[model samples]
Target chain A: MTLLAGHPTKVGRLAFVDQDYPIVLPVNFRVHRGSVVFRSDTGSKYMAAAMGQKVAFEVDDVDEAWQEGWSVLIQGMCHEITDPHQLKLIDGIGLNAWAGANMHTLEILHHRITGRRIV
Target chain B: MTLLAGHPTKVGRLAFVDQDYPIVLPVNFRVHRGSVVFRSDTGSKYMAAAMGQKVAFEVDDVDEAWQEGWSVLIQGMCHEITDPHQLKLIDGIGLNAWAGANMHTLEILHHRITGRRIV
Candidate 1:
């Protein structure tokens, strides 16, 4: 899948099933090659990463008045990045960490990365 | 645990662990009592529901320049609303389904609904 060009300017949203119901959240992300990466501290997202499963990422912009906007969806498998060497590489890229939490632990998940661009 | 007051005009984001990494998505939602609800078609979110697990839901608003906004986070167990009776109740509430897809099946999942409001 193609990463949206020019600094990947899109909001990242994630949807996963929790006990038969769906829970969704929005995140800031940086896309590279074939993986989508973001940072997180000890939380539910961390717990899910510990479980190891496939997940969904959706990004979109909509204007209610115009009834128009574009959305990009990425569906793939993700794996956490734990190797210190890899972590350092991610940090080197200098992505904006806007979550305002200490994500020093740095978990990187990669999705198979298929996307649909809808306008 | 409390639902954000008044029609819950916040963006819903879901974060889940996929194969040792975290994936996040943004969604539209309605909150009532102690649960958060939304609709979906057959997708990854549906698969996660079928697995029966807890998930995370985050809602926030941020104005970059002001560096200020409020975020509400809900972490809990979710169960799909499969019973026809409950399904009808959800439809009756008339929450706006803005996803623009045929969510006629109406799968409702309830989170334990704990939230932190950060401004």
Candidate 2:
């Protein structure tokens, strides 16, 4: 499967560009209508992910017992969402923002999502 | 502290440029000589991280009960290690490669490693 199937944490990462260097951050994200969404604050990661910047999101899981795992890499354009209507949609998903009561939602959309599993 | 003091996993991520779109991948990595190292195969992620590519590596952890967490972002250059002496040193570090005897070690070195913890 091009996407992870039947996995629990659904944890992914966000990567953006800052002064010719790439910055990577681990984020708790969810899949929404073929798009990846997460929560961020006015931090360095959030700042670098200015609207329209090319970015990436990745998710992976490892089964220690089985000694096998799968990884998915998603490359897309970063979009900041401030629409109340859209925010309401993601609010229902219940994100573990870990930020004290003030978090902003961001989304990344791409044409294709790629994944690989070593079984 | 910019680095995780007591987090057990010590896992980080690697981000690289793949034809203009950044690609992020979660990897079980370790910090050595102030550098981030991980095991990779001859895959897309490995291919793109050839020689000296400006990349980023990150690590983060969350305590669900504490409702707080910390994240570290590392930006650096990707260097592939084929030297037997270096490979032997990394092998002694005990990495859970999860690959079938054919994985290669790659290291990303950076001048500065940055992290933030939300309490």
Models 1 onward score TM values of 0.56, 0.83
Q: Candidate 1's residue-wise lDDT over B1-119, tens digit each?
A: 24343434434665555553345544456664446676655555543643344567776664433434555556655456677876677677655444555353322254455443334
- Candidate 2: where are CA atoms >4 Å away? A1-7, A42-45, A64-66, B1-7, B43-45, B48-50
- Each model's DockQ score: 0.23, 0.64
CAPRI tier for the interface of model 2: medium
Top of the candidates by TM-score: 2
Summarize candidate 2's per-residue lDDT along B1-119 as a digit string, tens digits.
23533446655677878777887765667655556777776554464554488888877776644667778877778887888988888888766554555467788777567777779
TM-score of chain B of each: 0.68, 0.80
- What does the lDDT come to for candidate 2? 0.69
Off by over 4 Å in 1: A1-10, A14-26, A40-56, A64-94, A101-109, A117-119, B1-11, B14-26, B32-34, B41-56, B64-67, B75-94, B101-111, B117-119
| Residue A116 alpha-carbon offset, candidate 1, angstroms | 4.0
Question: Which window of ten consecutive residues has the lowest lDDT sum in model 1 chain A?
Answer: A1-10
